[model samples]
Target: MKSLRACVAALAIATLGVLASPAAPAQAYPSPGIECYTIIDSNGNPQIHCIAVGALQEIDWCKGCPWAISFKDDIVFPETFDIDVIQGVENLSLAAAAADPRVAARFHDAAIADFASAARGLGKQTASPGPVGVYDTAHRKFVADNQSWLAAAGQDLADGLALLQKSFGSRDSAALVKAATAEFDEAFKEISGKQVIGG
Candidate 1:
């Protein structure tokens, strides 16, 4: 019986050690395939970074959510290509997921956590992102870089998401999804396109 008690004590200490470990180290934004971001690097050059966070419920949930881009200064576009079609939507709960409004808020809440967690996932922004309207240099470069494939407003990833919000509210986001398919299909054909996230 004393041996059994010793075993239990060992298990408890092991559990505590695992629980008290330090958090993950910091990294860059807009992980690959899962999500994308276009930015002006500190060197005055354009940088397209698409990175993926681990399946962290609190962090990754917000990182790839519908409202994710609202968190970053340089977060210009959403990777609508794989995000909606393959990876992102499976995790998110649309506001209009059900016909009942009573549950919509619950869905939205569970799918998209608050900004505090987002801040943790995105970390503090030290670099100053220059000019930022619709015609800003970063945006212009993102456009010019991907002009051949992602050229039009219809194919604009962020705009596609705007339409998506309305469609979800109406519970018929077919057009929203349809709007981006052909263009992204062509995007896949471009060089290093699987890893190249942009525009």
Candidate 2:
């Protein structure tokens, strides 16, 4: 009986060790407060905002990371369509152009010119009327409009990815992983309207 009890105790100890073993650190999920900003409405009402939807919570890093974005209830763009697609297109175009200089040069030049014009306009002190009849006195309105456009551009990229994955039968793990990472990076760039890091 004592031997049997000893064996049971050893088994219990083994089980406890397994349970207490450290798990691999989870992938960093987009927790709230990581990034935040605010926006104003047409009526000049200020609203607090978060890019993700729910109250941010940390999850196991080993599991897939999910992000939630939230905004004013009456936001002009719905959450589903807020991602920018044009940015992705621009990035993809630039990358392609880099590989083939001649074909990409014209597009790159046009993009640069457009960006330059906007920047120059922003640098000016006088306020100008924007498309929505809003006065761009401080250039705040101009920046916001540009930001919205970039977000739409990202959405476009996401759509492209969905289509590509569907058509290509992304069954190969390696290829699928590559494609997913690209899409995610592109989407992040579009939403943030910034250069992707570690690409």
- Once fitted onto the true fold, the runs of candidate 2 whose alpha carbons sit more than 4 angstroms away are 1-26, 29-33, 37-80, 83-178, 189-194
lDDT leader: 2
Tens digits of lDDT, candidate 2, 92-161: 3342323345544555444333322322332222111122111122333221222242333334333334
Q: List the residue pairs that clash in candidate 1.
A: 30-51, 31-50, 31-51, 31-52, 32-50, 32-51
Off by over 4 Å in 1: 1-38, 41-147, 150-159, 178-199
What Cα-based lDDT does every candidate model obtain?
0.26, 0.29
Instruction: Tell how far residue 118 is off in model 1, in angstroms.
Output: 13
Q: Can you give the lDDT of residue 25 in candidate 1?
A: 26
Candidate 1, residue 161: lDDT: 37
